[model samples]
Target: MNPAQTTSQQPRQDSPHKRADARRNHERVFAAALEVFEEFGLQGTVPQVAERADVGKATVYRSYPTKEDLVEAVVRHRLAELDRSTAPVLAEAEPARAFETYVILLFENLARDRLLSEALAEGRSSRNTGPLLDRLAALMDQAKTAGRVRPDACPLDLRVVLCGMCLQLINFAERDPALWRRYGELTLQALRP
Candidate 1:
């Protein structure tokens, strides 16, 4: 067969420019979802995000099957942000100090992030919290190795404790913005060996 025939017979591939445009559309939808959700809370509709993204409603649905999925993406994004913030702390010379600082940053992000706080309250993103927990487990393992953390203080325990603390603090959002922090600090203290 001629090379031209072989090439023409093969399935066509998306051009690099088209692929990049698709990616840009996906990202635009992601950003618009977060923006709409923040402006109107998680109750914001997909159409709103489509409008904000300047894409069709089908485009948003194609990117995220449902509002929950979109919110879950945002939740993952927020946790990833928190996880990235702890990267520098992992290099601290003092293992225990690093762990404490990690917990502190976790609590700070959880306290201020309305999307995370609200999602936790509503039981969204219950399935995927890997980025944050993976980092926490690493830190815990390091601290444990140094004999600074309780042998049994696992990442799951920290997650439950933090979730509970954040959920409790959601009630105090209007009354006392700082009240939830003490619970986080107390929980951290309990985890110390």
Candidate 2:
């Protein structure tokens, strides 16, 4: 092959503009999926998500071929956002405050986004939560040591309580929005030593 032909045969890198467009498309797809899933739960279809995103069905399928794939992707995305929001608090020196802040953030996220609440409520297993659970366990241990948390209050108990409260809010928020704040306050009170 000629020298010029050799250069042409090499794979081309995506231009900056193309990369930006891809990023935007990704964001749009993710946002649309969240909305669709929120409105329809796991029964939401890919075509519906694609329509909501204003992109071709092929575009959505290119990233996630099945509804399950889309749901998993959306869950992973939400989990990442949760992790980012809680990371700073988890790093703080005060374990009780950190744990409280983390729980509050979780409650707030669940209240604000029905999609995330649904995703979490589905009880799908994802490996990403292991580290988060470990961190929470460490924080609980610290709080127990500091006399902020009760000796019998384990990390799993905290998770179960907070998650149950959030699920209740999601289930009842349509009838009464006040339930979210009320349950949140009650949760905090119950968690305290």
Candidate 3:
């Protein structure tokens, strides 16, 4: 196969030069924003993000005009990655198994980065939990229909159970991985119908 004749697979863009600079600036902002937001939260300032990215504050403002805009960008990026990873699982796996696997993957992601976990440790923020809960609740409905999960168990309750377990694991994993592991198994078994 001739390489030149294969395909021009670059992402389609409205303007090549603008896209190039936008991509670079977006990458810089994402990296810095992820770190800074995780550390300082929604209150993280534009100057801090610019310093972390090693770009001018003007660049940060160009990419995100406000702190909420920056948080939205960061959340969008991370949630996009999570969606990619879980799409196949959601589509193809058995409902109960899909839910279990989703929770496990969520725990892994939360555990991998302290800052991300900390940002979401709060019980509020429907923005953070709404998508995840909806996915799990859909799976739970399917599982109940299939007799794979307890018919009486509420999906919302299950979501809370899983979230609470994960929070405990996040808090104590460093101090006691063994204890967390034990509780993890117990929680998983409890979710089984």
* Top candidate, metric TM-score: 2
* Tens-digit lDDT track of model 2 for 94-190: 7657766666666666666676765554333346445555666676687778787788897667767766776666666442435555665677678
Per-model lDDT: 0.72, 0.71, 0.67
Highest-lDDT candidate: 1
Candidate 1 or 3, higher lDDT? 1
The lDDT of model 1 is: 0.72
Q: Model 2: which ten-residue window has the lowest total lDDT?
A: 121-130
If ranked by lDDT, best first, what sequence of candidates would result?
1, 2, 3
TM-score against truth, every candidate: 0.66, 0.73, 0.68
Alpha-carbon lDDT of model 3: 0.67
Cα RMSD to native, each candidate? 5.8, 4.5, 9.2
A best-first ranking of the candidates according to their TM-score comes to 2, 3, 1
lDDT tens digits, residues 45-99, model 3?
8889999888888888887888777877776667677889878877787665776
Which residue pairs in model 3 clash with each other?
none
Candidate 1: which stretches are off by over 4 Å?
1-24, 38-44, 118-127, 141-156, 174-181
Taking the candidates one at a time, how many backbone clashes does each contain?
0, 0, 0
